[model samples]
Target: MFREQLARDAARIQNQFDLVLGGLDDLDVTQAMAYTTQGGKRLRGFLVLESARLHDVAEDQAIWPATGIEALHAYSLVHDDLPCMDDDDLRRGKPTIHMKWDQATAVLAGDALQTLAFELCTRPEVGVAEVRAGLALTLAQASGAQGMVLGQALDIAAESAAEPLNLDEITRLQAGKTGALIEWSACAGARLAQADTTPLRQYAQALGLAFQIADDILDVEGDAQKAGKRLQKDADAGKATFVSLLGLDAAKLRAADLIEQGCAALETYGSRADTLKEAARFVIARDS
Candidate 1:
């Protein structure tokens, strides 16, 4: 049910983005924008919307701001797939921006998208300047050197190390690499609604961890066609993962436990949190 809702929301947002991109010139730029914006779970946007709804913010009030988060996410994916990072050739069952076009085009496109993300945040339709400022700060902190970039550096560093990682080290790496942006998505929504952020932050932290645990499991057991990316890459890279640290069964159990904790963190919001609660379950249960 949550996945269906997310898909619907994604489709709506994709249409909006298409409309926004219609005026762009350069073919490479247009291609890169359209390619990266294609099919995603849109979980980040959903988090933003659901977090806003928890505070009684209307959907219309949430959409434009949520689009900002989604734009940032797409920008990250483009850069992450570049030759310097994962060097991934494919994403979401489609050619990566770098692969579809060229590295130069990909780099510039990613740069443009990053700026566009901030533009969306500061748009006149995005409500007050104070809220926009808070959201933009959250996004920068999550996406920049202090957060996801640092995490990616750790991941790269771990790959070159001869020694295996301990659980704490792995946790630190994943928290920055994957968890930070996920946390930002939820936090941004809470900020937009001017809601108390303590519980939202806690829930996002747990959700991010659970999401990574599930990703680790999927790396080992997921179908390549469904996942839209290379499977068993973690094992091949000898990268430390939850399943590598703990056995697959234990990792699965840990994911479930984290999801429960995530749900518990939002208990005060009651049914307003149903989408987020279901999203937690979906993260672990997803085949892709």
Candidate 2:
């Protein structure tokens, strides 16, 4: 059910993205923007739709923000793969934006994508004026200096520091880098429905941390081909990840515990949230 729903959501969001991005300039930067946004798990978008459904929101009303979050995620990936950043050449089994185009074009594409995310969020189809405004504002908060950018800055600083980060520090960094967006995506339905966000917020907090822990574990055990990007980067860079700090077995155990807690957090929704429960388990089970 999880796999089926994920695939369906991904396809639906992609079509929405295509429409949202239609009639842009014919330049390479815009082209690169489209290219960089294609082919990924679209997990954040899936969370948006699923959470909205859990709140009894219609799919049509939910898809705008789903597409918006995906654009924001894609922008982050584009910049993360830059020559000065992680400097990777591959993403989602294709050449990254900077590698496929010039660095300037890549930068422009990423900037354009970020702005497009805000534009999508403000679309009438997302919800009422209040929901649209809230989505845009929260997206800025999640992606700005205090959130994802802060995490990325810390990660870059860690590379130059004499000592690797400890578990607690890494956890803080991962919460900003990964958990914030996941939290926003998970809580969006509540924001849309004007329902209480506490339960889903709790679920996402655990799930986000587990997802990062699983990424660290997969770096040690995953196939590079299947993972669709470079693996073992932290090990090669002498960075401290969950797997490095706690050992692979311990990291796996920790991730399992997190998934359990995440599932348990959804108990308030009963069977309606079973798919979300499966998503928590799948976070640990997936290779990519």
Candidate 3:
């Protein structure tokens, strides 16, 4: 049931993307934006929708931010796969944007998608002006210098640093790299309703960390075909990851513990939050 709901939500958000992007000029950059956003778990969007459901926000109103988060995520992935970054040739079981098009097109597509995210977030359907402004503000913070970019910069620095990052350093790094957007997505519903976001914030913090740990585990032991991208890059690069810093078994244990903590944080919502708890489990269990 959880997986089914995830698929349904993914379809919904993808449709939203189609509606928005379909109207744009059919340039290569626009094409790349659509292509890059085409497939994924759509986990971040799911968080927005699920949290909105828990808060009794209508799906019509909730979907704007849901789609917004996904656009932002797609932008990040496109940039991350560029020649200057991870330099990956594949993503989501297909060629990266830079491979399909050119580096310039990929860069432009990423930039356009980043701006489109804010446009979607600020749409009048989302809420009152304050809610829209708040969503946009938090998104900028989550994806900008203080958040994912900072994490990426840290990662690049670590690769050339004299020493490999320790577990604590990696934890802080992943909190920004992976956790920031997840936290924002989970809390968006509360922000929409102007409700306190402490519980969802806690839930996403744990879930995001667990998600990164699971990614490290997948990097160590996962099929590249199933993962839809290159795996074991961290190991090849000699970079420190959860699976490298701690043994694989220990890293798995840590992820499980984090999942438990994430689920526990949703106890205030009882059965309404079961899907999110299942999502936390899926994060570790998924191959991609």
Best by TM-score: 3
lDDT of 2: 0.91
Model 3 segments more than 4 A misplaced: none
Rank list by TM-score: 3, 2, 1
Top lDDT prediction, candidate number: 3
| TM-scores for every candidate against the unseen true structure | 0.96, 0.98, 0.99
Task: List the candidate 2 regions with Cα displacement exceeding 4 Å.
Answer: none
Instruction: Summarize candidate 1's per-residue lDDT along 1-288 as a digit string, tens digits.
Output: 687888877887787788777778858887788778878888888888778777777777677767777888888889899989888998999989888889998888888888888888877777788888887888888888888889888888888898988899999988998899889888766787777898888988998999999999999999999999988988998877899999999999999999899899988988878888998888899988
RMSD, one per candidate, in order: 1.3, 0.8, 0.7
lDDT of 3: 0.94
In model 1, state the lDDT of residue 217.
92
Off by over 4 Å in 1: none
Q: Which window of 10 residues has the lowest lDDT sum in candidate 1?
A: 56-65
What total of clashing residue pairs does each candidate reach?
A: 0, 0, 0
Q: After aligning candidate 1 to the native by TM-score, how far in Å is the CA of 255 from where it should be?
A: 0.5
Higher-lDDT candidate of 2 and 3 = 3
